[model samples]
Target chain A: MEYIQIANSTPMWIAAGVAIALVMFQALIFARKSYNTGKTIGMTDTQMKSAMKSAMITSVGPSLVILTGLLSLLVTVGGPMAWMRLSFIGSVMFELMAVGFGAEAVGVNLGAGDAMTQVAFASAVWTMILGSIGWIVFSTLTADKMASVQDRFLKGDTSLLKIIPVAAMLGSFGSLVSGHLVALNKNTVAAISGGLIMAIVVQLAEKKELKWLKEWGLAIALFGGMIVAAIL
Target chain B: MSDKRRVYEKDYLPYIVRYGKATGWLAVALSFGPAVVLAVIYGVLPPSAAVFAAFIAMASAVGINWFVEPISYFPIIGVAGTYLAFISGNISNLRIPAAAIAQKVAGVEPGTTEGNIVATLGMAVSVVINIAILTIGVFAGNSILVRLPEHILEAFDYLLPALFGAIFVQFALMRLKLAPIALGIALSLTLAVNAGWFNFLPGRPTYLITLGAVFGTIAIATSMHKREARRD
Candidate 1:
């Protein structure tokens, strides 16, 4: 479907340009804000750009590889190949954007905004997947050893794990609802709205301690599943 | 040595561990029967799309846990419940799990952990009903009802949007993020109006639409904030 288009016609130059623009945008904002606040880290723009370039180089490899794997499979088989590619790509980007939204949701719910503000938004999506895999592995294996890692990173606190489930729920919420939208024939809008809903809800749930987070998710799943089945 | 640190460390571990164990167990039990049901349907329904749908459902079920709020176990409930509803004719199959999911989304624990047990029992009962339906749907297939082509089945994707719209609207009203709520509506509407226009988006049209909607809303919100700031 769309994946084939991406794999074939997607100008790496264009994709690379957009990715670089995003990196520069982040660096500029960070630099300006830090300068205005007079809390100079003394790092030069050149250094920052160098670091950003290297980071993108490392991460884009995995992302593109994954993208190829996701898109290519659909074409090989010949069904709605475009749909599958698009869904997979949509899911990845949504996951990336959700970090900001997730942070907002958590902040609203727990008054954890200040802490969230300190979280580096750059490279966040990669960090999250990496972190989660790390946590899952650590938790499942040397549960106690992982405790030390948590303590070290969190400055001797590990209660963040309690919040892990909320984040996971948000991801699923975004993906499935977005999937539903894609299924329902409202592609782009569905992905964006679903992603936003997830981001904001997690924030709302985190701050206000809303109980319906679980409820709405279940409703979406069951009702959505029913609708899927009915149409099929 | 202080109580805060101790609470964050020792006492919290046992509770978190217990909760993790409980959730993990709930997840396994919820999916077991659904997997079996899908297998049966795979044999009987004989749609190529069934494989994709089943893969998505299972992936969404498990993958959702990684990204969304795991504090609530309703994904498990929904996963199990959907299969049960599919198997059984009972509408009640929709109720408890739906309620449970809704409750969690609201940020309230679903009455008690005891609700999980009740949900499981309800689902088990639905499975029995499903078996009965399977018998009827199979025997009555060609002689009893009309059939649609495979391509038309793809349109069922919209159910996700409808479900998300209904749920998110309710959630947004509660949280007071009227802006995002409005964005959700607008995005869904746009997709409905110009589905083909989104084809130009990079990966998937759905995702492009989503990104477009989110950023578009953000721009609008930013301007609104600027206006409010100027007024103040």
Candidate 2:
């Protein structure tokens, strides 16, 4: 009983302190920036609280999923390897969701991909790169069009006509390959192949204009990459 | 609506605000204390059994905090931080010296009791160290939370598809091109069916999944963009 009590009680306090510290630090930094810019935080205290709550809600489920998965996997596997693997998985999960939801938020045709394959380095790097590319390209080539889409999404009136294709494309290629590789215990190759596939697929899809078909082709290549990477 | 008129008034605060300070502290308390207790037990308990017990206790705390509602959210954060502390300690193998010091300072049994007074202090020290490192580690003019080394950063490059895939589900439901969606699915299925074939990559599953997501996103994005251009 004594042992159990100690194990359970102390960490909570410690974590709370850390969380508070983090929150405070970020808030202070932002506040300073706002002051220097001659602009106040737009939200009232109430609005701020609401926003935090909403963000917490949005982020909590995913965080829990990762936590539960991590704890279970840790217990079963135990040690640095498990930690590394779980970290990789968790990072991918968050990145994918951020992209998918972010695309819709902006009303762009930007899509998302698989949750599992995202554990590889390729997924993280490419998403950041492609996301940046999307930001630049859309802003340069179709600023008004993108803004219009963003307004529509913010108004809570998005059309399914635009989203399904995006999701499908995002889901199709490199993620599948990465997921397969990880499950097969080939973490490194998965990362490499996934990255390469992303570069190729993005470039090819952009040029071919047969995006849907290209997505399929990329998917096939991903699988083939796995076979070739794995067998050889 | 005037900027000057906006005072720090609270209209609707979260439960954290409503609960008062002590209650909030209690929430934090309940979540993290158990992990500390478990760490203390690691001393006396056999290595195998100790690890098992520690894991179970940690899981319970994590579970309770994670699945429960906003009312219980704070505790989860607290506990998660604590678990992180324990992991940090375990990985560092900081058991004996820390345990001895804890027993001396708190006048508690080293391996017995819940480590109510002593182990808590010891773990607290560990937490402080962990946080301090994280804090100072954040350099100016660069990422303040750069946890990954260069190698890991390199690894992150591969995870793009996986991240996007996870978000794909949450991508807004809108009018979408069925062709891209269909193609994406077809490709994913093919890869999954022949997952065994992709053994060549270093990171098999992660690679496969990342590959899938990258191509998937590209496929959809390009198709939709082209179609829209055609219409224009």
Candidate 3:
């Protein structure tokens, strides 16, 4: 059978499907648990639903952005693996590089179509699997401990407690921004343009009482950044 | 903290941690599904040497991040969220923005119990939504994606920077003063790295800038907030 045929085989689909289904099942369970817990914490019906709605909307653009990279993965690994991988821990760059490393090990260059032997494909798959295992292992071992650490912090003074999350978020975002602003490239334009757009839109929404605008802020900012990057 | 909040520490978080551990370990195991099938069923194993080479390459590139990134994201993501985000991945580009927007619209601050509930809930929603979109994009995407204008597809590249910029602003706007501080620290660190000051570091030291920016901003801003409170 052709390599692509096997790549898109029913068995591969089933393998991919089961992993994805587990993720979906876990998500549903967590979401429900959170909703029940939210009620106890004073997250009202309106707040819960609205947050979900806002998240749902916010996810659309980025999710679509994930999709835009799908073509590369599809050609590289076929539909099922691409679907499973991208839907889970796989980023486009990582997957591509892992595959390249795998193919290179077997002495293949990852050129267009049929250049990938079964052994090379196998190598790529193994590389991706073994390569990403550290995260899962490290996270599983330490997640509960990490949760405990958070517990200690939560018990700290109320005034300081409030400041930690806010400051952490600001710093996290600052680091993200610096990554893009490393040089004056399209990314810089996108970040600056997007930030400017977000500021304007948010201010306008607040002043004009445009609740819908507030909800759609991320989508608007993402698209605005994309447009500016494309233009400039 | 009030009794309402106490219930979170006493009742809610414990269950999430326990459940998260069980499911998180399960995900680690399940992540190996496709690779096993490719190896066992297809008899497509590569040479052990080739596999080792791939391992070296993969590890050299992103190994430290497998552990480092998750721990850094703990403050914003919370307990349940750490489980879900790490398992499902795409924490920055997709998950964080989703959770941030949800909390923003709902007017909940991160680090607090209520914020954790909302952030986790929001992230859970994002995981399901992301997979759903990818599912569709995989089966039907290629035909449609190929037909879309190249210019539009090119536009997708900019969404990430736009997202980072907009999200930083979203959180930065809340605290106001820390915005410039975080940005400045991140920029200096990034520039210093670019100038080869940190070449002695292993793998990619630029990655550590995210940590520095996050922890540095947290320390600086928390002190500022406390100092101002004392003055008041």
Candidate 4:
């Protein structure tokens, strides 16, 4: 069978499906555990439901972006491989590099139809898997220790504890937004518009006590900016 | 420590650690299993050396992030959230924002046990939403994607910048005075990189610029916060 056919084969689907299923199972287990723990820690049902709603709402725009990435990957690597990798543990940026390295290892260019063979595809799969292992290994080995490190850093200074996460978030987001802003393109436009929209929505939500605006602020800003950029 | 907080930790941390380790290891195995199955079926395993070479090449590019990201994000998401977010992937683009927004909506302070649980719940919800969307996109194939209008597809390119901008503003609102200073540093660094002022730096200078901006903002914000606390 041709390599492309093999890339989209039933066996590949089964393998990918199993991987994806395991992730879903893991999520389910963790969600249940966290929910029970939240209740024990005095979290109200309203808070839990609100958190779940906000999370779902916030995810829609990013998920659309991920789907766009998947579309590009599907054309390059076929459906099953792209689906499995993206759904399981891969991001758009990392998968592209790993797949490229895989193809390069077999002396082929990815997305070049006739160049990719079964052997090259296999090599690419191996490269993608191996390349990403460091993250999993490092995360698994140090996760507990890292938590301990954080605890030691706190030293029971509960008053200042809140600032740590908030500062981390501000710094992280500042860097990310500035990267986009400096592009001086539609990205710049989108980013500025999005930021402005969010600021307005949040201000309104707080002052007017418009609960729904707060809930949908991010989504509105994201899509609104995209629309503004497109129009411009 | 509050008795409730102590009990929650004593009772919950053990289960989280055990299950997190179990699932994390399982995820790693699952990640590699597909490639092994493909190799056996095709009987075309690439040279081990070649695979290693390709892995090294790819890892060299992104390996630093494997360590940096988990640590940088640990304070915001907590241990359980980190485990789930890292395993499930898409931390910056999706999980972190989801966790952050959920915590905000639930009025839970981050770095607290309640905050950890809420963040975990948010991440799990996002995983489910992300998986569901990817599943639909995969199963539907390009039929749906290809039908998207050209303008809409163009707009999708702006989604990420917009999302990041929205996220930045959400956090920036919390510390109005600090936001501009952080933004100024990030913008200046990005402009310097873009203008080729950092030509001496190796690889993409954007990363260095980003790190500078993040840490610089954190330092400035921390000092300002400290000064305010002292005055109070």
DockQ of each: 0.03, 0.04, 0.78, 0.71
Measured against the true chain A, the candidates' chain A TM-scores are 0.22, 0.25, 0.92, 0.94
Model 1 accuracy (lDDT, Cα):
0.33
DockQ of 1: 0.03
Write the residue-wise lDDT of candidate 1 on B100-180 in tens digits: 233333233322222222333333322222222322433343332235454434433333443344344433333344344
lDDT of 3 by residue, A1-232 (tens): 6667777888889888998888888788889888998997777998889899989999999999888787778987888888888877868998899999999999998754439888888889888888877777777678778866865765665666667777777777888888798868999999998888998888888889776787898889989988999998
TM-score of chain A of 1: 0.22
lDDT of 4 by residue, A126-190 (tens): 88888776777788888889877866765665665677777777777788888887778999999
Judge the docking of candidate 1 as incorrect, acceptable, medium or high.
incorrect
TM-score: which candidate is best?
3
- Which residues of candidate 3, in runs, are more than 4 Å off? A111-114, A151-155
Q: What docking tier does model 2 reach? A: incorrect
- Alpha-carbon shift of residue A71 in model 1 (angstroms): 27
After superposition, candidate 2 runs with Cα above 4 Å error: A1-51, A67-169, A172-232, B1-169, B178-193
Can you list the residue pairs that collide in candidate 4? none
Weakest ten-residue segment in model 4 chain B by summed lDDT: B201-210
RMSD of candidate 1 to true structure, Å: 22.7
